[model samples]
Target: MDSNKNTAVISVIGKDRVGIIAGVATLLSQNDININDISQTILDGIFTMIMMVDLKDNVIENSDIVEKLNALGEELGVTITIQHTDLFDRMHRI
Candidate 1:
């Protein structure tokens, strides 16, 4: 991962199912977003994931990604959200 690249946090939550990661990854790859780190787990029957992605090389606008992700989430029966790393940090800061 390139440390200097702009980054964003992507979160996915929904019922456990196949292809959640694959779907999200494929979309990101198509947009030139690079995954820097990922963590996922199943709590009971729910699936949750957090992905840190490098967006400096992305070819599309962030708003477009958000729209695409929202569509994908509907298709996959999951909720997907993205936020810039800085804003995410600030929102959660104590």
Candidate 2:
């Protein structure tokens, strides 16, 4: 099996604030999800982050993460979106 087949893409976007990265990282850490790559930036006071994470060791399903992230996003006042890496690629392919 491809090692990255279990990978996922997590996206966060909202007004800049403290603890966005920390919150997401903490959740993933507690769930045994490892971050493979991450890129974040602030644009005109808006915060944007893209994280490529490995779910091979994760104990939860992708739907579970989506729910958890949605709740976290509400608390943090941001929008969180997650998709399997394969699905992401398929949707983005032109």
Candidate 3:
């Protein structure tokens, strides 16, 4: 997943419903971001997804991506969080 470039982990959480994936994927697609890894599932009707995306030279900054994602979240009635890969990994690693 282009180890030499910077990446980020994006997560979305909310009630399960249609277009969750499409909404998020559409934003990413429009921004020219590449999805490195993704997994999603429904737990008791709550939708959750984690995506590792490559952001190097994506025509947008980290903050810009976060802003757009947050907007999408608002429209989709979800909560979204975007974090740098290194920061996320370090913070989550035991």
User: Can you give the TM-score per candidate against the true fold?
Assistant: 0.85, 0.84, 0.83
Candidate 3 lDDT trough over 10 residues, lowest sum: 56-65
**What is the C-alpha lDDT profile of model 3 across 1-94, one tens digit per residue?**
3245578788999997789888898888888888899999989888999999888675345348778888899999999888777775566775
Error of 1 at 93 (Å): 4.4
Best by lDDT: 1
Which window of 10 residues has the lowest lDDT sum in candidate 1?
Answer: 54-63
Alpha-carbon lDDT, every model: 0.87, 0.86, 0.82
lDDT (tens digit, per residue) of candidate 1 on 1-94: 2234478889999997889999999999988889999999989889999999988756335349999999999999999998778776666775
The order of the candidates by TM-score, greatest first, is 1, 2, 3
- Model 2: colliding residue pairs: none
Q: Candidate 1 — which pairs collide? A: none
